[model samples]
Target chain A: MKYKDYYKILGVEKSASADDIKKAYRKLAHKYHPDVSKEADAEAQFKEVGEAYETLKNPEKRAAYDQLGSFQPGQDFRPPPDWGGQFGAGQHFSEDADFSDFLHGLMGGRFSQKHGGATMPIPGEDFEVAARITLEQAASGSEIEIKLSVHEPDAQGFPRRVPCSIKARIAKGATQGQRLRVPGKGGKGLNGGRDGDLYLKIELAPHRLYRVQDHDLYVDLPLAPWEAVLGATVEVPTLSGRVRLKVPPGTQAGQQLRLAHRGLPKPHKGEGDLYAIAQIVVPAKVSERESALYQQLAEGSDFKPRSHFDLEVADEH
Target chain B: MNIEISEAVWLDRAGVISMSELAQLSGLSEAILLQLIEYEVLPPAASAAGGPTFTGDCLVTARMACRLQSDFELDAAGLALVLSLLDRIRGLEAEVRGLQAQAPRRPHKA
Candidate 1:
């Protein structure tokens, strides 16, 4: 096994006082705490620091570890062959601390205890994973499956993997970033303790046709120029199905029309409204007859499209 | 392959859980949890004749406090401050997201 210099990990000297060690550990732990730190590997770094402090904080463990003299971090080293039976079965570190094999070897298998008689209870650590779903799935309830790699302690305290697949129910109107908790589905507890719960974070995949803002859904509604000028009833697509929406007379581009109760489902309430924004489209190509009709209308009409530009210039001047 | 259907109970959906269940799920002692509640690190949602009840969101908060206590040796006051600050940050982030969602589309840069 590679030697791990606990003093080096804590950035302290081997002869440093216990107070100095404690101060350094506190500073590093606070800096690297996963919830507070924005570092990508803050969690891993925090665990490493915790492991280092676990050994250095205790005098007995420190003395035992210091016996392997002058060994550097990452150097090949092994504990003395006669060192296996000295430690007792009592656990010192926290339940979530999955100590390295080096520490386990030093303690003659730390998790190994006398299971034939009464055993100490240690609850397993909770685990989390994201479950991604489509927008339609978020609107309507669906079932999802996720795989978790659980660590099971053997009869001798050696760790082994047990792959578990869980099928979960997603309730209707579940929004992005919502967490669904599953009870007693995490890592196995030690000595018959209860298993930890699993937290599934919901992630809504982006949709091409719609944009979601909370429960409200937005879609671009393209219409012909004549249809925008004259009132028309048009069909719009919603999560549930298609519904006919009325376009009021003289509807302008960029104007949004609300279709009540046609958006995503809300918890303990009716569905939210969908906003369909108007986009007027003009024909790029015209036949001779259509061109003549358009020319006649353009000559006969008194409408001025640039009337707003004159007002804007006068305001600026 | 056999498909195992999990009889999952969504904590957020349930909204409230008993104190004993919270303790069991968070792996914290009842006394320490009571201390946390007393310090306002986590507030209970309701109270019964037996004991106080907490929201499912408190499960995450209690578990986090437990870990921070173990890793950094923080006291109840420290846990309370940290948890409150974290909650504020989450609120701000959600507000920012809502505002962004409401904003109109910007013109494409040339």
Candidate 2:
């Protein structure tokens, strides 16, 4: 594991007070929070800062950590003598961070268990936020704004809305219900606790052309009776917009035509499929001539919508 | 590499869920979550000390199960299959995100 410099992470002096450490953490936290930052390592660095703040903000932990002497960035390190004695010697340390092995060895395991429910403890327990995007956004991926309530102003001020701009990545098959985590935009940690994370659950609005089911995209292609009875090339809508599709003769309603690898495309996995379901459209209000033509057709072949069921019932008897 | 380092980790994930949290999070009665478990549509959560505890995955699975039951009126088995398929699809998406992130980001032309 990489050695963490708590003081440096918190941006404070070695002799800084707990209050000073906390103040520094809050400032850095607001800046590097993944929901707000576009920096490459912002999320990972935020977690690191949060872990640092968690260790240093408490007096007992800080005192013990200080006793261990300075942590040289590239040097071999070890815990101070009698590390557990510092814990609970006075106040209960808040659950400000999820500490690391080094801290746990130095501060003890009590930090993890006792600190629970101290950070960002809300009645809802979890906050769920979703974003609705167009098909285009999902196809090309997008950077979008999702507003999250990071804080409710105290008696001293107005309630403020923390606008979080996140670069949303469209999953190869991210149809809907796909979620991404933006660290540190959630409810504020309690008693000077580390802030919870912000979740971006995606919901794609229904498209006019394609209906997505998992990795598959579905489209209903309307065909004339002749097209259904005799195969022909017809225009259809896809995620890529209009494309021509072949309609086989004697195609039935609910009969699906598969387009391999024409749907959702994954990174490593093979692409998903597009299914075109055939629907035979007959004019509800036909002209006299059209009605006469239909009448002539009706006089021709025998078709039963529920033939199988009739056979089963008669066989049972 | 997908180490579940914390509880809040599941707050964002759909299928990952805790046992007691499953019903409460989805605004569904306990009976409902239990029914999902009974039907085997929803995978039962992990247990500690003989008591049932769930992982983060259950939350999304339960929410999806509820939506399926309500929206499309699908039965338990159908909901399970659909949710499983959805989870697999999500897995594919995560893979794509990883590739995109690594896809040689270029500095714009000056």
Best by the TM-score measure: 1
Every model: Cα RMSD to truth: 5.5, 19.4
Q: Model 1, range A1-317, lDDT digits (tens) per residue?
A: 56778898899999999999999999988789877787778877887888888888888778877776667677766566544335643333333333354364344332454222338776776887889999998888788999886666555565544577878887787776776787777766777777777888788898876777778887778888788999799999998889999999999887889999888887556888788878777676778998998899899999999999999999999
Candidate 2 chain A lDDT trough over 10 residues, lowest sum: A90-99
lDDT digits (tens) for residues A199-296 of candidate 2: 56778787766766555667666667788888899887776767778887789766888887777654335666888777777655778998898888
Highest lDDT: give the candidate number. 1
Worst 10 residues of 1 chain A by lDDT: A90-99
| Residue B28 shift from truth in candidate 2, angstroms | 22
Q: Model 1 chain B — which ten-residue stretch has the worst lDDT?
A: B101-110
Q: After superposing candidate 2, which stretches have Cα over 4 Å from the reference?
A: A1-127, A152-172, A187-195, A300-317, B1-110
Q: State the fraction of real interface contacts model 1 keeps.
A: 0.43
Tens-place lDDT digits, model 1, residues B1-110: 97766654545534888899888777678888898888887888888988999887788788777787777777777777788898898788877865555444532222
